[model samples]
Target: MILGCGLQRAKKRVEVSRTMGSNTGDQFANLGRALSTTASVLFSAQPMEETILSYSSPYKKLLHETITNTGGGSSLVKMHRDLNLSKGKNKGFQDIYANSKEFFKNSYSDSKTTFKVLSYLSDDLLEDVPRDTIPKDKNLITESGEKRARKSKKQDSTLFQGFEASLPVINETIEIQQKVTMNSDMKPITDSESSVSNIEEEQRQEFSLPNHLKAEKLNNSYSSTYLKEAAKSITDNLDLLEIQKNLAASEIRELDIKLEKLKLMRELVFKRVAKIEQHELFLEKHLNNVKDRVDMIIEYNMDKEISSSDDELLSRVSESSPRTGETNEDYETAATTPLELKDDDASPLLSKSIYQQLQAHERKADAPETKKAGSSKKLKDAGMPNRHRHRKTYPTLQQFYETGSKIASFPKAHEEEVICLDFDMPFGTMCSAGSLDHLVRVWDLSKKKQIAAMSGHLASISCMQMDQYSTLVTGGRDAVLKLWDIDKAISEDNGDHSEDTDACVYTFDSHVDEITAVSFDGDNLVSGSQDRTVRQWDLNKGKCTQTIDISFATGPMRSQRNAPLHNSVLLTKEPPAIGALQCFDAALATGTKDGVVRLWDLRSGKVVRVLEGHTDAITSLQFDSINLVTGSMDRSIRIWDLRTGTLSDVFAYEKPITSLHFDLDKIVISNNEPTIKIYDRENGNHWFCGEENSELGDVEFVRYKHGYLVEGRSTGDINTWAI
Candidate 1:
C-alpha cells in the first residue's frame, strides 16, 4: 500500500511538473524512482530477515537448489512458488513442483545480489543527488529547524513521512549484522564452546542478564538485545568451563593420594630389604664358624685314632719288658687279662655324662645298696626320661612341602588295626613299641630286635602312654587299666597274662565301658571311656581318684521315657560314643559320635565348653597348644582353637578321615581311601602324598631316633617313612 501511494504521488508530481515545464517533470521522475526503490528494498527484506532468524529458513533449500542446478535455471521465485504448492488430502505444503533434494544447493550469488541491491538503493537515496532536484524546502526540517529525530505527533496516514523515517534505521542495522557475520574478531560458535541451546534451563534463568532492550531496539537496530544474548552465552560457557576445571582438580587430588601410597610402600620395601641384607650377613658369619668347628672336630678324631692305635701297641710291649723284682708269670697274667682303664686312663672320646654313669654303675656293682634308690627324689630326677628329641636341622615349611620324603617303614606291626602307638625312649635304654594287640612289644633299636611283649589287657588295648623308666599304662575295651614294668617284663620273663587280682602291681577296673584314650599328665593318669567318663587314676592306691561323667551329668543313663528330663545330655548319662579323646593340662577334649567335641575341666568335673560343627561322628583328633584338628564321618577335617572354642579352618576330602596328625607347619591326614595326605598348615595346599596309610592304619611320628612317619595298616602292614 505504501509503494502504491508513492507511485500515485509520483504521478501527481508529474502532472504538476508538466503544468510547469518538461525539465521539471524529469526531476519529479528522479524523486519518484528513489522513493519507489527504497519501498521495494524494505518489502524484500521481510523473507531475508526470516531466513537469518530461523535455521529452517525457506531460502536455504531454494538457494541451495539454485546454486547446484543453475544449468536448469531454477530461480529463487520459481522455487518459492513451488514450495507454496499444495498436494493430497488437505492439498497442503508437501507439494512442490520445481524442487527436491536433487535440485537444492546454496545460492550464495542470489543472497549477495539481494544485499547489494539494498546497499545500492540506500546509498543512492542518502548520497549524491542533483542540486536542482530540491527547492528551499518548506517544513522539511522539525520545528527546531533540524530534521526531527523522532516523531512529535502521529503523522498523517496518507503521507510517506513515517515510511521514510523507518528506512535509514533498517538499512544501518542490516549493514552492522553483515559486518559482524564477516568479522574475524567476532568468535564463531566452536565445538568446544557449549551451545546456548544446551545450557540448563534453571541455569539460564540464574545466569540471565537483564533484558534492557526497548521496543525500538527490536524493530530498529537491535544492538542491545544482540549484546545481551552474547553476554549470556559467554556466561554459560564460563560456567561449563568452571565445572570441567573442578572435575580436573578432584582427579589431581586422587592421583596425589595414590602417589603417597606408592611412596609409603616403597619405604616398606626398602626396610624389608635392609633386614634381609643383615640376615644374609649374619648367616654368612654363622656358616663360616660352623665350618671351622666341623673341621676341628674331624682333625681331632683323626689324630685320636692314630694315637690310640700306637698306645695299645706300646702298652703290650712294655708289659713284656719285665722288671728285676717282678716275676715273668705275674707280668704275663697282667698282659693277658683285659686292660681295665682307670679314671686317669679313660678315653677322651667318651662323653662326661656317660663316663660318670659308667663309673657309678661299676660302684653299684660293688655295693648293692645303690640299687635301692629308685624311690629317692634325686635318683628319680636322675632317671627322668630323656625328653631331648634328637632332630636334624629344622627345615623351612616351604622346603618340607616341596621336598618331603619318607624315611622309614615297619609293615605288619600289629595283628589288628593299630588304634594307637606311643614311644618309650628311656634315658638309659630304648623299648619303644606299643600297639592295640593287648600286649606291649619292646624293641631294642640298637640290636634291631623285639625282646619283651608285656601282656595284661583282657580286651583290645584302646590307649597307652609311656611313663618314666620304660613304664607303660594301658586302657582297654575290657574297662581295665594296667600299668606294666617294661624292664621287669624283659629281664624276668614274667608270664604275659595274670588273672590274680593280688598279683597285678597296678590294675584298676573302674570304667564301665571301653576305654578309648589315655594320657599321662604329670603324676595323674587321665583316661576317657565309652561310658562317657574320664577318670584320673591314683597309681599309689590303684583306684580312680576322680571321675568326670561325660555322658549326662547328674542324670541316670537309662530312665523312664515319659519322665520330663531335668537337663540335656551330660556326663552321667552315656554319650552316643566317645570316638576320640585328648587331654591337655587341666582339661580333656573328647570327640563323640553325636558330632560334638566337649572340653571338660578336670578339677570341677564339668564341661567347660562344647564345640559343634561336624555333621557326622568325629573319628580322629590332634592338637598343638590350644588348637585342634578333628576329622569326622562328614569327610571333612575342621581345625578348632580350643582356647576360644571357635572353628578356625576346614579341609574337605572325598573320603572320611580315619586318622590325622600335625606338627608346627605340616598336616598329615589319612582317609578311608587308604591314602595319606600331607598339607602345608598355613596354606592348606596338598604338599605331599603317601600310600603307606592305605588300609586304614594308625599313624605315629617317631621324632627321637629319626623324623620318620610310622603307619600300622589293618592289612597287617607297618611302614615307616622319612619325613
Candidate 2:
C-alpha cells in the first residue's frame, strides 16, 4: 500500500504548476487581445487613423512580422482570441478550473463590448481629428503635407499681400478712371454752358438798337423835340397837299373863265347875226314891192295899146253906117251890122289889112325873070297875118348923150338913196335902198305909181340876175340863192292859178361862204362865192356841173385889206379875182376884182385870153352879135370885137361905168350918172340921152323905131323919149 500513495502525491504537484503557468499566459493573452482589439476597433472606426497607425505603430517590427506571417489585422485578432481561449481552458482539471471558466467568459464578453464601444468612440472622434495628428507611413505624406503647408502659406501670403499691394493700385486706377470720366463729362457740359451764356449775351446785344434809330425813337418819345419833329413833318405834307389842291382849283377856275368868255362871244356873234338878218329882210321886202309895181305897169301899158287899136276899128265901122236908108232901115242895119260878126273871136279885117300890106311890099320889090309865073301868083294869092314877124329893135336913151362926160351921178328919184335897180320889160321897174329897215318898192313905169312891197332875205341882196324865162335868180350874203317865177306871181294876182303853183322853182345851198353873184347861160346857171370858187350848175337838174378852182390864183386878193388909197397901193400885186361869171355858149367870161378879165373855153377847160387895161374890177359885161361891152370901176366902157379878140373902142365917163348894152347900130352905157347914154357904134359918137330922177346904178335900153328911146333908172323909173 505505502508505494501507491507516494506516486499519487507527486502527480498532483506537477499538474498545479502547469495550470499556474497556463493561467498566467492566458491573462497576458487576454490583456494583449483586449489591447489589440481596442486598438483595432479604434483604427478600423477611423480608417485614415488606422491607415496612419499601421505604418506608425509603436511595435511596428513585431506587428509587421506578426501581420506579415498572418493574413492581416483581422486574422491576427481572430487567431489571438482562439489561442487565448483554447489554451486558457482545462478539461482534466475541470473541477479545479470551473471559476476560471466564468472569469474567462466575463472577460471575453467585456472585452468584446469594450471593443465595440471603442469602435463607436473612434468613429465619433474621426471628424475632430486634425490633419497634423494623422501619422504618416512614408515621406510622401510628410512631403505632401509640407508642400501643402508651404502652398497654403504662400496662398495666404499672396492673398494678404495681394490685398495690401492691390489696394493703392485699384484705388489709383479707379480714381484715374473717375477723373477721366469726370473731366470728359465736365468738358462738354462746360462748353455747352459757355455756349448758352454767349448766345444769351449775343441775343441781348442784338436787342439793343443802333445809335441813329435809338436817337430817333428817343426824340419822338419824351421831350419837346418829339412834338417839334412831328409837327414839322405834318406841316410839310400839308403844304404839299395844299399846293396840289390849289393847282387843281386854278385849272378849274381857268376852265370856268374860258367857258364864260366863249359864252359871251357866242352871244355877241348871235346878236350881230340877228341884226344883219333883220336888215336883209327889210331890203328884200322893198325889192319885192318894186317888182310888183313894175309888173302892174307892164299890164297897164299892154291894156292901153289894145284899147287904142280897138278905138280905131270902131270909128271905121261907125263911118260906114248908111245915111238915109236906100233900102229898108232894117235891111241896111242887117247889111252893115259888124258884117254879121263871125262866131270866131278872131278879127278878119285886121288879118286882111296886114296881108294886103305884105303883098304890096313884095310886089314893089324886083324879082328874077326866070322865076315861075305860077310861083309868083301863088306868093301873091297866099294870105297870112304878120303876127309871126320879128323886129330886131331896141330902146334909145336921149339923156345918155348929155351925161356922156360924167363917170357917175346921183339924181333925186325918191327921198331915199337908190342902192339897186332892175327893169321889168314892157313898162315895169324895181328899186332898193341902203336902209337897215327891210323894205323894197315895185313901181309901174306907165303910171309912175308904187304897186307892192315884198320882203324876205336873211341878208343884203348882193347880186341879182333875171333868167328871163319867167323867173328871176338872186343871191345874197346869207349864202343862199333863190329863184322867183315872175309869171306865177302875176298870175296869182289875176285869181287864175292852181294852189300847187311853185312860186319859187328852185333854191341852191352850195356856197359855204357868201354868194357874190348869180348868172345863167341858156338853161345852165353859174354862181360865184367868197369861197374862191365858181360853180357851174344845170338849174333844171339841180346839180353842179363843174367847180372851177380859182382860189390858188386869187389867194393874195383874199388877204388884202381895204385901206386908204395910198396905203392900199403898197399891197402885193393881186391876181384876177373873179367877182362875176357869164356864159356865152360854151365859153365863160369872168369879171375879176383885180381889173383883169379872163375868158375860158368850157370844152378845153383853159384860159383863152386875159383882157387887161382896167385899173379896177369889171362891174358888168354885155355880149352882142359881134362885140362884148364891158363896164368897169375904172370909169370907162370898152368894146371888144370878139372875132379879132381886140379892143375896138373905149368910152370915158366921169363915174364908174356900171353897165353896157349893144343894139345893131348903137351902144348904150350906164354909169353912176342919173342918165343913160346912146352912142353910134359906126362913128363912136354920143347920139341920144335919156335922163332919170335918181342915181342910175343900172340901166337897160330898148329901141323901138326911129328916134324913140326907152330907158330904165336905179329909182325903178322908166322914161320913154322921142329923140
Candidate 3:
C-alpha cells in the first residue's frame, strides 16, 4: 500500500511539471510568433524563419531553428524560463503582443492595429514595471543571459556610435528641406525671429513622424503644386490661340468674296470705257470725210471757166427760186453780175447743182435722146414711180439731192412748213402731205398734180399714215385723231359734190395732251402723247379700247433736264413722258423720254420686255416681226432681238437721230443734218442721200419703203428718191 501511494504522488508531480512547462513554453513561443507575424506583414510575405532570423538578438537563430525545424520541445521551455528570468519587466509586453497579433491576423487583418496594440501595451508595461527592476548594466541573473546581455550591449554601443556619427548630416538635411517647404507653401522668412519660429514649428511636426516619413513629406508638397499650376496656364494659352486662329480663318473667307466682286466691277468699267473711245474715233472720221467733200467741190468750181449764156442760166437758177412749174411771166430777169457767194459761204450742194445744170444745157443740143434713155433706165431700175416710164425729166424741178440725186421734188408743196408726209407703197402712185397750216393735201403721182385738200385739224399735223383702201389717218397737236376717205376728199376738192359734209370720217379725241407719236397698222391705231399714256384704238368701233398708262407700267422714273425758269438756269427732275409709239397686231412698243422702250402685250396691257441702253429721249422706234429698232436723241440707234431681249446691232451717228425707219434690207435715219442716211443690212454699207450741192433741207419727217425715200423738209418742201 505504501508503494502504491508513492507512485500516485510521483504521477501527480509529473502532471504538475508538464502543466508548468506547457504554460511557460507557450508564452515564449507566442512572443516569437507575434514578432514574426508583424515582420511578415510589414515586409510582405517573408517566411517565418527568415523573418525571425533577420533580427540581431542573441536568441534569433535558436527561435528560428526551434520554430521551423524542431517545432516545440524541452529546450524551448527551458529557453522561455531563461528569457522570463532575464527580461522580467517585459513579461506583460510579450503576452499582449502575442494575443494582439493573433487577433490582427485572424479577425482584424490590419498591421496598423497590431502595431497600435503593441504600442499601448508597451506604454502600460513601462508604467507598471518598477524602474529598479529594469536592467541597467550588462550583467544577468543566469549564465546564458549573461552572454546574450553582453552581445546586446556590444550591438547597442555600435548603433549609438553610428547614430552619433550621422547626427549633423541628418540635422542639416532636415533643416534645408524645411526651408524649401516653407518658401513654397507660404512666403520667404526675411526676419530672423520669424524664421526661427517657423523652424521650431516644422521641427515639432517632423518629430511626430517616423524618421523615414519626414523626408517623404518634405519632397512631395511643393513640386506637385508647382507642376499643376504650370500645366493649367499652358492649357489656357492654347485655348486662346485656338480661338484667334478660327477668327482669322473666317475673316479671310469674307475678304475673298469681296475681292471677287470688285474684280467683276472693274472688268465691266473697262469694257464701257473702251466702247466710248471707239465711238469718238468713228465720229472724227466722218467729220473728216465731210470736210474733204466740201473742199473738193469748191476747188472744182473755182478752176472752171464758163460762157455768158451759161453764166446767165446759173445766175437765174441761183436768184429767183420760185414755186415749181410757175408761168414764165413770173420769172425775174437775171442781173449782169456773176453768180456770187457771200463770204465764200455758198451752200456746197447748191454750187454742185448749178454746175451740173450748165453742163446739162450744153449736152441737151447734142444727145437729147441718149440722155433721156439713160435717165429712164436709171429710174426704172431704182424703183422710181411709173411716171418715169413716160416722162423724160423729173416732174416739177431739175433739183438733185447732194449724194443720191432725187427723181422728183415738190418744192414749196405746202403754204407753210410741211410737218408730215406718206405715200402708197409698191405702186407708189399716190402721195400725201400735211403742213403746219393744218391742211392735208393729196397728190397724184400719175398726173404730177395736187388732187385733194382737207382742212379739219385745228393744230399742226404731227403724224400721218395711209392704208391700201384709200384711208388716211392723221394725228394733230390739238389732241384730235382723224380718219378720212382719200377718194371722197379728192372728189370734193374737184368740186364734184354740192353737200357741205366734212372730210373727216372719224375723229377720236381721247388724248388729253399734245400727241407726240402715232402708229396705224391695218385696222388698229395706237397713239402716244405728252400725257404719259398710250391709247389703242379700234377703227371698226372708232373708239379708244385700251389705255396703257406709261407711268403705271414703268413706275416713277426721273429724268434730268436743264430749263430756264424765271430767267434763272436750273436743273430739274421729272417723270418720263411717252415720246414714241409703234403698233403691230396685238403688240405695242412705247418709248419714254427717259430712253426706256417697253414692249406691251396689248391683250393684257402689261409690259413684257424693257429695252434699256439709250441715255436720252427716244425720238423714233420701229419694229418688225423679229427685231425692234429704236432711235434716240442720244445719237445712237440700237436694234434689239425681240426673241432674246438682247441688243443685236448699234449705230452711232454724228447728230441726234430725229426719225428712223428700218426693213429687212436697210435702215433709214434722218438726223438734224440735211443728209438722209441709209444703212444697208445685206451688204453692211452706209449711204448718204444728200451731196455737196444738193438743195436738200433739214428733213424733219421721213419714210422709206420699197426703195422709195420720201422726206418732208422744214422748208415746206417734199422730195422723193429711189435707192
TM-score, cand. 3 vs. native: 0.41
Which 10 residues in a row give candidate 2 its minimum summed lDDT? 382-391
Global lDDT of each candidate? 0.53, 0.50, 0.60
- List the candidates' TM-scores in order: 0.40, 0.37, 0.41
Clash number by candidate, in order: 34, 38, 9
Give per-residue CA lDDT, model 2, range 653-680, as digits (tens).
Answer: 7777655546676766666565666778
Q: Which stretches of candidate 2 lie over 4 Å from their true place?
A: 1-416, 428-444, 450-454, 493-502, 552-579, 687-723
Candidate 1 residue runs with Cα over 4 Å from true position: 1-404, 425-436, 444-448, 467-469, 490-505, 553-576, 692-706
Candidate 2 matches the true fold with a TM-score of 0.37
Pick the TM-score winner. Answer: 3
Task: State the number of backbone clashes in model 3.
Answer: 9
**Model 3, 677: alpha-carbon shift in Å?**
0.3
Task: Put the candidates in TM-score order, highest first.
Answer: 3, 1, 2
How well is each residue in 210-267 modelled by candidate 3, as lDDT tens digits?
2233445455657877556555555544543444455557689999999999988876
lDDT of 2: 0.50
